[model samples]
Target: MRRVRQLAERTPADRERYVDLLRAVAITAVVLGHWTVAVVGYDAAGRPTGRSALPDLPWAYPLTWVAQVMPVFFVVGGFANAASLAARRARGGDAADWLLDRSARLVRPTTVLVLVLAAGALVARLAGVDPSTTRTVVWFATVPLWFLAAYLLVVPLTPLTYALHRRYGLAVPVVMAALVGLGDLARSTDHAGLALGNYLFGWLAVHQLGYVWYDARRKVGARFPPARGVGWTLLLGGLTVLVLLTTVGPYPVSMLNVPGEPLDNAAPPSLALLVLTITQLGLIMVLREPAERWLRRPGPWQAVIAVNAVVLTVFLWHLSAAILLVGGLDAVGLLPTPPVGSPAWLAWRVPWLLMLAVVLAALVAIFGPVEARAGRHRLPVKDAAPDGADRPSDARHQRHPLRAGLAVAGFVAVGAALVMNAVTPREAAEPLGLPVPALLAYLAGAGVLRVLRERPDTRGPTPPASPR
Candidate 1:
């Protein structure tokens, strides 16, 4: 037991290969999920409907298991934030500055993307295209922007959440779990308050698990090696929960299958999702070493890094690019209006999805450098010591497991608020154009990031510059 405890004390370094691999995988799943659902259709009045034509593919339902990969993203986010916060604190940096830097990184790239898309929509409208069509296209294309809005809101609150983690430890996960369970029950019973809470509490609960993992790693250290046994247990447990909920319980497994009313799992998230996160995290842990070795190869690792750098951009613009491809194809009379659930429709969708990716890549390639430059903020850097040995204060901040966990909770709260405001009766009924909610969300997120970035630095004693 003493040996095990000692091993646990030796925490691994910050750069965990498995986490990066998981992030890449998660992003790919998101892109493919969007592609699977990216069909172009016309409504009853022969106008374009925002539904995908390939909904009936045999593989579509099963894909949900892999397609609902957002939980992995949150898990990684928790880990990153936690490690970052811890590192910064050790370097005598304030929580505020750490929050500000992260918030800026997330918001800047996203804001540029939004402005460009909004401009394109405006230009299309002015060029005599059907205004309604243009509006719908823009709205559907920008759906992924919601993730950015949620992330920005959460990044600033990492310090508070991390504090909670430090105090409560595993109890944090237990409480979050109970909240999720209660929220699910409320949603099942049609209670508005409970339903709303479930939406915020349920997913946040899973995100908090990321903190749990980080803390456990810190505590268990080398003894808690990423092993196959842990991975299998988590995977089996998650699958069991998913089956129980979807089949025995009242919840639906198909997150995207909301038809009449919005699906419970589709919105705020459900208990089942929390299980999914566990399974994913476990699998990632088990594969950490091997995955890292594979990724070390220049060809694969470089691609992963490249994708990581522009992940937010790709997520935000992929849908828009899909809409553009469909519109262009339809305008040129090369493809017929897509029919929902038709095999022929599915065949065409493959190429359209590819076309969308190509066009999006082109746009990113052209404007990416400029967009990056515009978003860059100049931070003041200090010098190193004379012996070429850097002072402890000069070390780059490591992520705190606690801060990352808190950031997840913060994101969940902010995302829920934004979603509720946008979808509530009052907002829904307002005559504000379709794009208004999205525009407001983006602006609000940007505003929050700007505020966080401007907080006073409380870290004492700046280090001197090293001799050039």
Candidate 2:
């Protein structure tokens, strides 16, 4: 608590604290939602199984309007990335340098999670544990990777997308939304493969909106968020379209992927998800003023900082924490099995959530240091001259062609591996209890990125200062 206070006190006066607040809220909602709604246990045949209770709780689908907070994350990501890239460029850094810095933060913690899961899966397989059971557990543990995969798909393109944002403003997201709609239409007609295109376009659309929000903050000053009317407009308009899509059109009302649903909103991201994102953005904007004010208080601000500090770790290992709890309880034959959505189940959630929270806290404490270390590894960015002259020296901005290619290849490999695992979990689980190939691909990519990040300046010996 003291450390959190000190960190909160150190926050820059000019910083947009609301963005951090939103990120904390988004991740918290995701964690709690997953823990509360998920059902994991051994079946009568003694086979492990897992599923979301949202399928049985039809009444809960509409609640997903607020619970599915991925859009909020992407929007906050956009704002943060736009700011980060701009700062990096201002400090004479190029896209590769920025990529190295930004991607490492994600890749490092993710690497830790993947390696741990892979090792556990391998050990389980070697112990003669049922391959199917191991695979199911691994799948459940790896659920968080899908979001990382989607975020990574759009992260490397920030430089390109931010440039487009500068030129086209709101039009960038408009075009992206149109593409998502098209993808949704194609998927409706059974052209499922064609809809895969939205894997990038849909998330990118929500992300681009963050760029818009960034610009709006700059224009309106940090004290305000666009206009209240703008928020209302987005809220009503997006909700209208979302209603039509789900009801009159063919989209599912649930933002989550309900089993047996022919058309779900989330897997590849449908038009409905995009609109839900818009609606969410609207609600966020509408509340930003009050939220920002509340966040200024020491208690809330410190909590936000504390959570953001290990947000990725919390996200990455939370499901695994649940898995650990379930496995332990099941081994003792003490796991609860009330029918999902029943009153008994609802009552059971209190203690279930409490136990899960304790386990997740322990997991976060153990692995959270890795995330902190990654943040510390960031290379210092040089500030501009006092006169504000450009100082993007060759050494600072340029990259060796080979290193550059390797960086691109690294990113592509990581992105492709994650997408494959996310989009095709069953296939990724073959030959091992884990997604070994994907893990290898991620490791290879992270290795290249790590090498690029740590290597000395490739420009070689600094020319001696010319005689003044």
Candidate 3:
């Protein structure tokens, strides 16, 4: 509590608190939603089997639409990325320097997660556990990284995309939307190979909206009348499109991909999801005023900062906590897992979620500092006195060609590895050798980035920095 209070107090008065609030809310929803729907049970032989529990309820599909918060995350990411890039540019920073700064904060904590997963997989393999079980567990564990992979790929392109935002404004997202529509068409025709670009297009479009939000706010202030009513229209229009797509267009109503179902609204996000993003963006714009006012209070702002501090840790490990609890209890025959969608199961969700929260809190405590320490090194204020002037990080004014080249290679390797891993087949948590190449690539990238030239910049993230 003291630490949180201190964070609040330390925050610059001019900082935008609401962005952090949005990020916290979005991630919280994701964590809770996972706990709510994840159906972990035992097979006839007593091995763990899991899938989304939504189908059992029969009435929960519509709720999943409300619960799906991934779009909000990308929107927040876009805003932060645009702001961070602006700040970097204000102080003579280059594209590489800005990307390096952003990547380090993200990659460092992810390394810890990947390594932990690797060790767990190795242990499971040594136990003579079914390779299939191990493979399934590993794949399920890696599920969350899909977001990281896509976000990481997007980070490198901020310079280009931000340029498009500058040159074309709203047209950028609209064009991206059209491409998403095309991707959906290819998907409908079973041209899965050709539809791969939609993943990039879908997320980029949400992110582009953030750029729109940031630009509009800067230009017109948050109270702009035009932005407010867009929310209601988006809410209704998106809901209508969602209904038609599910009922009339072959897309699933559930935003999340349910196991045993052929439709996945998320994996290669469909056009319906784009409407959902528009709706989320609308809500965000409409709520900005009240949300910003509420966040201005010291206590609320402090909570937001504290949550953002360990947000990555919370995101990376929440599912791991749930998995451990479920697997451990099931192994000992102490788990009281009710039949899927049963009344008892519905009643048990409260305690189940509470237990997961407790465990996740502990995991955050253990791993969160890794991210916080790295964040403290963001670029410095553009100007400062020379007599022991405050510098943002411990960076020295030096550059290494070898280090820069290695950084390029490292990023490429990481991107390729994450993509390969995501597409690779894994049935029973058994991956060939427990090696996580992406973790290595990220570490390599971070080490190289650390050696790149560091410049001073206090233009800090539109004052409302969130992970992009």
Candidate 4:
């Protein structure tokens, strides 16, 4: 608490506290939503199993419009990426340097998670756990990796995307929306594989809006937040389209994938999800003023900092925490098996979520420090040199195209491996109960990035600064 308070006190006055708040809220919603709706218990065969409860709860589908916070994450990522890139450029760093800086933070903590998962898998295998049980546990545990994979896929392209945002403004997302519609068409026509392209287009489009938010902040200054009218427009326009799509149009109402549904809106996103993004964006904007004001207080702001400090760690391991608890309880036969969505089940959620929160808190304590340390090294946008007087020489921070390409390849490999695990968890989590190929890919990616970090600049020596 003291550390959090001190850090909060040290934050730059100009920093957008609300962005951090938004990130914290989005991730929190994801964690709680997953925990609340989870159906984890032993099957009739006495094997541990789990699935989402949404399939059985048709009444809960509309709630997903509020619960699906992934788009908000992308939007926040976009804002942060744009700000960080601007700060990097202010320091005379090239896109490659910026990429290295950004990717390193994500990769380091994730490496810890990958190794831990693999080690646990090995233990489970050696302990003679049932193959199917191990596979099921591992699958549930690694479910969150999909978000990391998707985010990593977009991180490298920020420089180009940000450039496009500057050149084209709202047209960029408009075109992306059109492409998403086409992807939906392909999906409706049975080209599910081709429709996967929406993953990139849909997420990138939402991310582009973050750039718009940043521009609005810059244009209006910090005293006033972005216009509320814009928020209303997005809220109304998006909500109306979303209603139409789910009700009259072809898309399902649930923002998440419901098993046995012919069409899933989330896995390979859809035009409907894009529209949901618009609605969510407006909602956040509308709330931004009050949110920002509330965040101004030391108590609320400190809490936000605490959460943001370990946000990535919390996200990476929350599901694992839940799975661990479920396994332990199931082994002892203490696990409850209320019917899905029944009043008894709903009553059980209170304790279920409470216990999961306790376990997740422990996990965060163990792993969150690594991410916090990595974050400390990130370039601070608020503190960036406004006059560019402190900018480093290009010769000192040389851009290495080859090294950048290799780093990107490494990230791609890691992301692809993760996506494979997310898509086919049973197949990917094999042998020692871990996704060996994915683990190796992650290690290789981390190693390549490390080498990139250690490699010396070759663009010639930087001259010493003259005494001013």
Q: Which candidate is the best by TM-score?
A: 4
TM-score of 4: 0.92
Q: Which ten residues in a row have the lowest lDDT in candidate 1?
A: 379-388
Winner on lDDT between 3 and 4 is 4
lDDT comparison, 1 vs 3, better candidate: 3
The better candidate by lDDT, 2 or 3, is: 2
- Write candidate 2's Cα lDDT for 3-53 as tens digits: 676766666666778888888889999999999998866678885566889
Model 1's alpha-carbon lDDT is 0.58
Candidate 4 ranges beyond 4 A from true positions: 220-225, 377-398, 425-429, 455-468
Candidate 1 on 1-468: residue-level lDDT in tens? 332233223323334545556777887788877776755666677654566422455445545776788877877777667665565555555454466556555656665665776677677766766656565565565567556545554555556666677788667767877787787777667774766655445555555666665655554244233578878887787778778877797776665544553344646667777776676766666777687688656556555545555666677677766766766776877656556566777677677667777988976776555434432321112111122121235443333445434434434444544454345432132222234564675566556556544533334542221110
| Pairs clashing within candidate 4 | none
* Candidate that beats the other on lDDT, 1 or 4, i.e. the better one: 4
How would you encode candidate 3's per-residue C-alpha lDDT over 83-123 as one tens digit per residue? 67665444444455566767667777877887777777778
Give the candidates in order of lDDT, highest first: 4, 2, 3, 1
Off by over 4 Å in 1: 1-14, 52-59, 124-134, 216-225, 370-448, 451-468
Query: What TM-score, computed on C-alpha atoms, does each candidate reach?
Result: 0.78, 0.91, 0.86, 0.92
